[model samples]
Target: MESPHAVLLVVLIATFAICNLVQAEDQEGFISLDCGLPPNEVSPYIEPITGLRFSSDSSFIQSGIIGKVDKSFETLKSYMTLRYFPDGKRNCYNLIVKQGTTYMIRATALYGNYDGHNNSPKFDLYIGANFWTTLDTGKSITGVGEEITYIPRSNSLDVCLVKTDTTTPFLSLLELRPLDKDTYLTTSGSLKNFRRYYLSNSESIIAYPEDVKDRIWESRFESEWKQISTTLKPNNSIGGYFVPQNALMTAAIPANESAPFSLTEELDSPTDELYVYLHFSEVQSLKANESREFDMLWGGEVVYDAFSPEYLNITTIQTNTPVTCKDGKCNLELRRTKNSTLPPLLNAIEFYTVIKFPQLETNETDVVAIKDIKATYELNRITWQGDPCVPQKFRWVGLDCNSLDTLTLPRITSLNLSSTGLKGNIAAGIQNLTHLEKLDLSNNNLTGGIPEFLANMKSLSFINLSKNNLNGSIPQALLKREKDGLKLSVDEKTRCFPGSCVTTTKKKFPVMIVALVSSAVVVIVVVLVLIFVFKKKKPSNLEALPPSSNTPCENVTSTSISDTSIETKRKRFSYSEVLEMTKNLQRPLGEGGFGVVYHGDINGSSQQVAVKLLSQSSTQGYKEFKAEVNSSSNFC
Candidate 1:
């Protein structure tokens, strides 16, 4: 018999243990990146959303390609600002994480028909250099997501998206949540990626401090079983497991002994071995003689036979035996054992498959350098994603790389920027590419004399600086290199002269003076001839002339009209002509304060004119009519 004091001490010790466990799990960090989120936005998740810190891609190079997703997917619409890689280049998101800690990373991509072309892309996902998963978003717009459990050897992890030929790559969401060390134990020193499905008779999503790891446990229910609801709420800790309380809070059991309760799930994994866990909790407190037993079967094979569950406490039974999947499908079931008094019940289930990753890619330093170079010069026309030199066929535009395989780091051997419209001084950052053998900056607007650093580049065997605007004497080191078999090309246009590099202006000064004098004399004679011709062509009745510079070509002046012969000058009428010309204002043109302007034919001629009927009530209209009459008197 246990003493009251000993029982109290045991409860206190258990309480302390649970507290410590909760604290450790809570200390884990959660980073959620909304990929294309608006820069500097600080929206925190709440309620239906997880309490995650949301961030944007402001730290990364601003990709010109961005798009919004449909509002129907509210969970993702908030993260619609997607950074798309139209150039089909590999883009990576570097996250600083705790070293030697396990983390669950999830990335989601949604086409949203964002480009309006409805072209879904296929790409490879990478963690550090290791291949993580393939992102093949077939034809669905629902968005594709891949989750992986990884332990970062370093303080950071690089989540990369590799573009393929089929479509452009893009990212919508990136979530990283640190997990408890003992959550998913494995023997191969490799972590197994688990997919959790929540089974319940209720409508609710369970996550976060309840799950501690914040895993999304999808809910499910059956019509045959009686739903047992528990008032027990999930606290921060659940014994030694970090699974959510909601996962183990609800259960469904059969009503009678004659009927058997079973849960069968078809896991969509063909040809691969699987690991499954069934979470159970006896929701009802049974009588002293009452016993509930069940048998769990993996494709008709009894893995756990005649297992009895304890009351009000969780008992998780996992399949130690790998279920061989046929045709990419494996079925698992939990049924009541024979002679058992109670029906079978389940709270949640977790499934996982082991994946064999391919060999990691080349060294990261060289890869990052090339990416920076492309970014610096805005060279986006070429799809430069993934390993630059691995696989050989696709190695960025105008760059020659030397590498043995995916295991070997590639070196940039040659660069061809000739006729690439590269302007200004040659980017000094090219110094980072120390392995270069040939450099061509020809036919560009590159200025500022040849950099002496080029001579220090011992690997360079050939260099072309032709047709550029470079000036000043070539560096002595470069000249020495030129003498020592270094192929150099600098045309006369780019090479500097012996003395100043600047042309002398003394010889051109006299020629310039003579040209100016000739120009001034020509201008004076032309102006006098124009004035004489204009005076002879002018008509005596000409009054006001429109300013030639300020007026449009359509605003013909009185002098230009009068310059015609007297016979060509038609008779002009005054204010009274408005009433006669418009035929009693029958033909409407447009409205104004001065009544309406009407399109009218001249009373005695075929000529047409626009006449305005001045409103009698408007003083401004009367003044405008008088001005129109005075203007008509000026015509020849």
Candidate 2:
């Protein structure tokens, strides 16, 4: 039995746990990352202002140097630390989300002189492979935030920081918030947030629990405008936008009731297209006899005629088509109608610039196949961070993609993983790259029989599997394909019937013995020929003969002979001695027209050597053989 005080404590603890769980559930689709936060630090740090949880960005990105801002400028937890990329031209964060889901992505940067260099850095930002914008972190400790509302084409999203000049690229925070797909509609392109303002007299920035999406709504107040407020919460449940009720509680109206409420905005460029959203909620409770109605005009042209705001209910007006400002200026006015007796009021407003993404993403099948291959091989190449192709300049290494048609998605055509230290059988994912024309997996330790699927890849015309430990007969399908003009390269010695295949290590003994005996016989024959030639050309008066008149063999026997002495004195080894030198022909470096070359060490020393054994079917006769021996001897 528990005491009353203990029972009460248990209940309180359970209640607190439930509250925390509920808060976490509210952020189901939200992803908040605190860049450069130490991996060992406590994650899911609940930000005090927004009550949103933030985790370390170590899992999102692979390249970056963790840095800390000057302590004096550390205002928030997210601002204290940052990830800076000084190595690569582009560093990206890979995020996974539901395909086709609408999302609001926000990235923040603050240059707090982390490197002790008071100079700030300027760099470019990219969403996937398309350029988003250029960010300039000013000299001050103040932070800059950029936001975009987008619908991801696939389940993956890449937010990249690209270095444009000599300055390094860094990021302080990255956040993703899922939104209702119908909320931010556009005719063609994504929406980049320009401004989101709530008409209010307060100086506080509103976000989070107040605005469920955690969109930062800054307060905007004009001295000449009359402020209207109500304690009653506006009805926001009717619309998908869900404009914060607190934001809708306050309204701004013209000081002079008869004059129209007007505002003007400056565009970034003359050709900039814009989308405007205006939120209105009547803060005043009027009698049935009185009404508030206004005509909304854009650049002196009526856009919405005689619109009336329902008292205490949020009404949002959005542009159906993109509005282009003239001379880089846009103007809007809300005027009272003849039937209305009140001044026009505005509660909140949002401005967005339409950003068209011209570059198409890689084909879904290719992307999936490449991603699977990367995972299977556990490749960690830095350049493989984002889309394999697109943006042209940052294409993945060893990959050739076909992106000639701008309207169609890019497809992978070639993959070269030669000498990349790959193991195991060829990746099954490679067959899915239907457009791949060539694949080079040579100079690796890969084993197992060649996959028959390679033959099904109709586009494949070149394949290299040389210098590997593979065994078993080549797939008949692949052999047929090879006969059909496919350029295939494989070690013929390693090929055997399927069931008769043996490990290379077991088969190497017989080959090594044969190579050893053949090499010794060649050396003895060369030596015998040199001795016989010297006997046949025996010079009777050796002391009286001129230096140039002496036979080549006479120069070899002389100790004073500089170049030839080293070659003539080169030690000869027996078959067993050669085996000991080459580790019984264990490791093959590569093959050549003459024979196979085996890697060897000299006299148990670190000095490396390449031991070439002449093939039985080599076309070279005695002259070529002698020339080869002389050349090798000269090299030694």
Candidate 3:
């Protein structure tokens, strides 16, 4: 027979190996990002404590600077570094997830005085376009984390960090764990985690390898409570909640075995709604005549009239409807029933606050189209980090969305890429904007003929393709649309009708040669005339002429053209007038290489305007600025 100690060691080793195999197979849809970890650093490593794989966040976001935390808190690799956003008002991580799949999204932040400034920062966190919560990294090096159970409307989810105060917004870790679709269902909106704890006498935290879902359950024990635990593992094959057996193995009962087990929580506000989940198991063996029965109460109201924990089996109790503590306090008590001979006990508890997401995301097709366009052109606009529409104030620059109907998803109505330094052929993705009304591609280096898809877009009423090096025949469909009231603008010299394109180019070649020959003959005649005049007229006669008359004709013509240009120059607004128009530059539209654009209204009128404020540090010269202004004026 094997020794007892040796048998115990063999069992432990087998269990450890099994847990490792389970974790390796279960992480299919898990996404764990270690923010600010450099691309060249080691990544995709399994964290020993949680058994979850973590990778650098460089691929998920485009903005923010990386910094290492203070050396004192460098024990955990995930907490050693962070990503801090100091430029844009909002920076986001674009996470790709299965559409309609429920997920537990978690974001962690730690301020270990990374900037050498001891000040802790407070900022707002957002899920897609809706506000999730405000995170305050208080004066401790200990980190803070927020988790939410959500189902994204589309395949992509945006986790945004918004700068709400003077302090910068930073993130240490971001994780996504896919949950069963039927689990954690809410009537409407997402659920934000408030507290998740396992009743225990130990100080160690329990997560993955024990929980299977990688949920962090902190130990909680009150001096007034008596802890009861069993070495036997509880059967946790209940619902999809996945309450770990280790958590259910321990139970908390009142120190006085006959007293009711109770817990009280104070609500942040009277209107705050909450969902509570209670997990229980009979960890202690009972005598033949002993029985344990209880009635669960919330705020003095009985929720469950009679409840009993099956021996060594998981029993989960959750609120069917959201509960509100009107008086600002919630009291949960499990009172022993009249027939019960044992005390009421609890194994674990979880609390979540109901968070309503009323704002709808942008139309999926338009979002896909715009993001494709951004990729096609490699647009690096600072303000293009989140959703293209919804949350009206933060819409992407150069995009006008139609969100008049609250029930309908927002659609991109106008896109202004005028003088934005776009290159290559016109993007085909623009055709996906089904509701697009106006498009401005003027003053770009786009070199392709207009795509036929544009003619098929019935909603497109205006198109400006001027000042490009395009040489092609206009499609008949487009010409028809133009005749039927489409406002089309193109460089007429470079384009022609279907049959006339080749003939037109052929005619232009000879016409250009004839014009050059005529110019040469004119120059010869002028030279001969000047020589004859010089020979016939005396030097004194030439000197008698006015200085202005002696000037070359080319100089006079150039002067006349310059005067005409000055006369036709657009009106310029003063700094104070711009401020008044833009209401002190409060509504930002977007930022580009030139500067930031502000969405404003013309003073005393309902007309909307976009004011491009030049950055003081821009390296572009006056010529580019003038071209941008000219493009805008022509579009208007």
Candidate 4:
């Protein structure tokens, strides 16, 4: 017979060994068993039961048919309408997968008619929960099938089966099992600590007295000391994951040249890399050819420090890794191995790096500048009595550019001056502008003859002279060669001359004079010639006439009464001669209803000569004026 105590000891030892073997298997066997051989490539997935689903695991029931599911085991479910067409994939569900883990999923259909129905449609299996995409691998099955060893992300994943039915279908269930993404030998280690290091990252950065700069500088070093201290705090740093025994650091200063700066204490080697913490302090870009202090350690104790005389540049953090630990916290710290535990005082070591950047300079630019911007136009608001156009801001509302593209003049070629209270004729000085295009002065209180000088503008295009108080025949010479190339448009009250659109009768008299004189001049000339030809010769009427006589036209007599006409002939002279006269049209002695008197030099003597243009272009002006001049006649 065996001893009872001895048998118990043997059983206990065997149980412990078995437990270890199972743990090793768990670590190694957690990968999908898919070899990609047709039927061997199994799909891994499980579906939620009793809901509207488009997966192969779901089936639809008609009014009289009831859904049947055998809950051989307990499950998670909710009752709802089951409506999903397989072809359209309406009401499909999703599966989540961990980033770096493996899993196996399988599904099979237990098809039986709830109301003694016919055969249901087929189903397709898919494994992935990408809402934007669908998985390519799965089986089309009418019967039950088994699949194994699917993969999950590093954490968890989902698998699904889609009902290939043209109509909606209900599902029983889909099964999923975590699997290994890669093959590995069985081994043993504490997952708590391994996971921490695997999850953490290592980084360090230097600041320029600014939080933004501090954040940017904290990306260079990696070490275990930082990972533990950063718990329960905000860590958006890139290297915020798990870290090991290694450490890497760098130093730098701000760009201010005149700023008085200080240095950081020498790095203390506790266990090789003892006081390793990231800070947003000064930053320096070290050169690759420089030197830095590097220490080494083993078994939680410092061995040696590899320090060079030349300060070094830190391209990467260099330190011993894979430090032993039991948990993710401060399990196996490699702090300054045997040195004093006091924290480093910044004022002690006085060692750091610095550089200076030059200040920026600027220069002046030459461009057209704006100042005291101002503009004016007519505003026809009856409510506001004063001229509203002068200051455009306080004006009639609609008297502006139709689109109001800007506060300035209209950029287009058109202008509208309709219904404005303009009381005066267009001034002659207005024609000084050469670029005036289209003009509208309709519905205004203006009265004047259109300026004949307007006909001299060659760029005149479209014009409207309608509904104004103007009364004048269209001047025939406006289109005539002597008048220029422009045309005029007019009706009862409106007139357009050159580029100007006259709005009233104020310009009508001058317009009529031009029309009559230019259009009827030739006819009058014929009548005058006939009169001169028919004149009879007088015998002896010559006698000594008084020096200053008032009679001149009385001397020459026209014979035929029917051929008499009082038509004026126009004379053209050099423009330079007119400029010389009246001392270049300046300083007129007097201007009146008849003509003008100017101080002029006649034979080197300053004389007050009255020069008459006689309505500018009168038919009888030349002869009468000359006769009066030659006879020294002064009705005065």
Per-residue lDDT of model 3, residues 1-636, tens digit only? 111111121223333454554444478899999999999988887764346789999999999999888886634556778999999998989999999899999888888889999988999999998899888887334777788999999999999999999999999899999987767888877898877889998755666778777677777888779999999988997877888888998999989888889887776667889989999999988999999999999988899977889889998889888998858788888899999999899999988889998888899899999999999999988899888986787889899998865577899999999998999888999999999999999998988777888899999999999988776777889889999999999886655666766544665888998975774465345334433543465111011011122222211122221122212223334345555666766788888766567776653434466666545445764346546654444333
Q: Taking the candidates one at a time, how many backbone clashes does each contain?
A: 5, 0, 0, 86
Q: Which of the two, 1 or 3, has more lDDT?
A: 3
**TM-scores of all predicted structures:** 0.54, 0.76, 0.76, 0.17
Q: What's the C-alpha lDDT at position 152 in model 2?
A: 94
Better of 1 and 2 by lDDT: 2
Model 3 TM: 0.76
- Descending-lDDT candidate ranking: 2, 3, 1, 4
Top candidate (lDDT): 2
Candidate 2 structure quality by residue, lDDT tens digits, 353-381: 99998899898789889989998888988
lDDT score, residue 10, model 3?
Answer: 23
The TM-score, computed over Cα atoms with residue i paired to residue i, of candidate 1 is: 0.54
Task: After superposing candidate 4 on the true structure, give the runs of residues whose Cα lies further than 4 Å from its correct spot.
Answer: 1-66, 69-87, 129-143, 153-170, 180-636
